[model samples]
Target: MAAPLFLLAPPRSYTSLVNAMLGQHPQCFGLPELCLFNVDTLVDLWRGSAAEISENGPMARHGLLRAVAEIYCGEQSTATVNMALRWASVREHWTTGQVFQEIVDKIHPLVAVEKSPSYTISVKRMRAMLDTFPDARFLHLVRHPVAQAKSLLAINDGAFTIKVNAFEIGEDYALMEPQIAWHDINLNILDFLDKVPPAQQMRMRGEDIMAQPEQRLAEIARWAGLRDDAEAVDQMMHPERSPFACFGPINALFGNDPNFLAGPTFRPHTPKIPPLSKPVPWRDDGKGLHPEVVQLANEFGYV
Candidate 1:
């Protein structure tokens, strides 16, 4: 079996679109965010999160549901989702790694490409993935901290920050800080990548992919040991062709970002990169980025 390719990044860093783009490769099967490693066993996904942060809600299972529905039954419908539920029930006692392997095996020959932003929330879950697939390749997807934090605040009223507990606790006012989440999550990815052999991993900037997809995609294809010829590159150019690129049935509605689902098409254009020292637009107090954020963003090649 070919080792699966996993994209690692914080949420809203163009992961959904990129995952689809990569999946469209003729030799690859782009998967929705399975989020299987968030728990130890298949059953834990249904039990929901007991931690301060609730990780295993209905939305968390949506990706797996859509995947099972489409893979097993060849379609996603309320009926298929029910079948998927029964499918999961029988393996409730199995470890998440085992369940993922089943899905990977089911889709053998083609590489499985997946990215769940939640996986970066904990090193243990990532370690579990490595333990399960020793040959798995990791692509540490990155975006400018400034751009990423702003995108986070734009969605769900910045609720993602709460998931990472990214906040500034002052003597008086406790403030939600999205940059903290950005810095720390990337930090977590870096620390985890330290354990992985350098050859099994690569880093790419999301903005670069957006700016020049054909070039970047071809570069990635070469790195993954896939076909980098014109035919393969052309296939990757249309991420919309991937089955999981669109919204699933009503029952298994989403396994990807809704924005991407609404418009899964890829448009190539250069992204704006803001100066790291300026005060973030989301803040009113005129405080600039934390020193650590600047350091990290610089490390990511964001000036």
Candidate 2:
């Protein structure tokens, strides 16, 4: 089986766009966030882990259900999704790695490309992926801490940060800090990537890709041993062409970001890079990124 490509990043790091774009390649199959690695066994996804902050709900299962439906039944209708649920139920006793290997095998030669930002919450989750597919390649997608933190707060008041226990405990209350999430999650990815061969892992700035997608996309295609011809480049430009780009059926309405689902089309525009020293706008007291965040961002080649 051809090992899949996994995009590792914290939420709000342009992972959805990049994952879909790469998946759009003629030789690849983009999948929604299966989130399988977050657990040890397939049933653990339903049983839930000890992390209280982690996202859990029927909705969390929707992505896997939708992907299974689309891959096996060639569609994502409610009926197909129900079939997917049944399919998952049949394999509930299997390890997550086993279930994931099945999906990769079913979609062999297409180069399955996937990203589940939640995987960055812990190094163990990522290690689970490597354990499953030793040959899997990793893309460590980075965004400026300032921009990433801002985007995180904008989404459900940084619920993801809380999920990852990115907080500042005070005498009176605990405050959610997106920058902590930004630094810690990237650290987790970096620590995990340390175990991967340099040739099997790569790092790219999300801003760079936004500014020059054609060049960057082609570079990634070449790195993945995929065709970098004009045709492949053109295909990568249209992430909306991916089956999981949009919302799924009413039952499985989201296997991806809702904001992305609302508008999955690729629009070329350079994302603004904020100065690390400036005060963050989200804070009432006008605080800037944490010192640790700045240091890690610099390590990531950010100014």
Candidate 3:
């Protein structure tokens, strides 16, 4: 069995593009967000989040639904997606590990490359994935906190973080908590990575990958014990070339980010790096990043 390669990062951190790029490699099978570890059982996905209705809560089940439909039935047709639900129904009694192993088996000999942003919300969820794929290679992908937070707010009225249980309400119903998602998610990744063998893990900045795709991707391939030749790097340059780059059937539009699905092209542009000490855009008051967020950003090579 080929060991899987898991990309560990919070949302809007270039995970989708990077996953697609790596999947385009000859020996790799980049997968959309499988989101298998989020729920204790497969049925819980349809149960929705315990939180009230939010912009992102309704779409939480999308990744897993798409993955199952694509993997089992080949295409994500409505009928196949329904079959995926039935397939999950049969395995509803099994552990997530067992279910994941079954999928990995079906795609045997090709390395499974996956990144699910929701996995960063809980240490337990990360642990669950690790326990299942003990030999899996992890790519700890990090982004600038300010850029990430601003992008998160821009997407869905900041409801994405809220849906993940990362926001807090003040007396005036104002959201004033600092770095709740960014700080905790990175902590979860760091803590979990400490348990893995150094040989099995590689940490890279999303900025670095964006700035120097060839060099950073080559390093990643080498670290993951895959070929780092010209062919591999060239393949990693075109994320759009991946089989799962486009939207699936009508019933399943995305197993990945919708924005990425519409346009998965890779243009070489240096993303603007926001100042670390400046005020964040999400807050009414001009307060800067929390001390913890700064430390984490520095560790990620942002500062």
Candidate 4:
């Protein structure tokens, strides 16, 4: 079986768009956010895990439910989602790793490309991915800290930051700070990636891919031992063609970002990268990125 390709990055880091685009490669199967590593067994997905983070809601299960429905039943619908429930019930005791492998096996010969930003919250979840697929390839997707932080705040007033416990605790109050999650989650990914073999890992800035997708996409496809010819690269350039690029059935509405889902199609354009030294637009206090955030962004090729 071809090992799966995992996108490791914080939320709002272009993961949904990139994952969908990669899945459009003729030899790859782009899957919705099958957040399998967030728990132990199939049943644990429903039981939910106790942790400081809290995005594991019904929406968290949408990806797996939709995946099973589409992979096994050949569609994502109210009926198929229910079928997926029964499917899970039969294998409820199986480890989440085992369940994920089954889905990957079902789509054999096509590389499974997936991204679940929640996995960045805990190194244990990432380690589980390696434990399941020892030869798995990881793509550490990064965005500019300033750009990413602003996006985080723009969406739901940066509510997702609360899910990661990203806060600035002042002497008198605690305020939601998107950059905290940006810094820490990236740190989590870097720390966990240290355990992965250099040969099995690759890093690329989200801006580069957005700006020059054809060239950069070809680079990654070549590295993954996939076809990088014009035809293949052209296919990858149209992420909207992927089956899971849009909303699923009403029962399984979102396995990806809602914003991306609203407009999953990719256009050739460079994303603006904000300067790390400037005060972030989201903050009223006129504060710039933390020193550590800037240092790490520099290492990621941001200035």
Question: Pick by TM-score: which candidate is best?
Answer: 1
Better of 2 and 3 by lDDT: 2
lDDT per residue (tens digit) for residues 56-142 in model 1:
777788899999988899888899999999999999999999999999999899999999999999999899999999999999999
Each candidate structure's TM-score, on Cα atoms with residue i matched to residue i, is 0.97, 0.96, 0.91, 0.96
- Measured by lDDT, the strongest candidate is 1
* Structure candidate 3, residue pairs in collision: none
| Candidate 2: stretches off by over 4 Å | 49-56, 170-174
* lDDT (C-alpha, whole model) for all candidates: 0.91, 0.89, 0.81, 0.89
Worst 10 residues of 4 by lDDT: 48-57
Q: Which stretches in model 1 have alpha-carbon errors above 4 Å? A: 49-54
Which regions of candidate 3 fall more than 4 Å away from where they truly are? Answer: 49-58, 164-173, 176-178
> What tens-digit string does per-residue lDDT give for candidate 3 at 56-110?
2445556666777777777777898788778878878777678778878988888
TM-score, candidate 1, is 0.97
Worst 10 residues of 3 by lDDT: 49-58
| Candidates 3 and 4, the one with greater TM-score | 4
Predicted candidate 2 versus true structure: per-residue lDDT over 1-303, tens digit per residue: 789999999999999999999999999999998888877778878875334334545667778999999999999999999999899999999998999999999998899999988888889989999989999999999999888888998887777877777888879977788888888889899999999999899999999999999999999988888999999999999999999999999888887888999999988998888778989887777778888888998888887
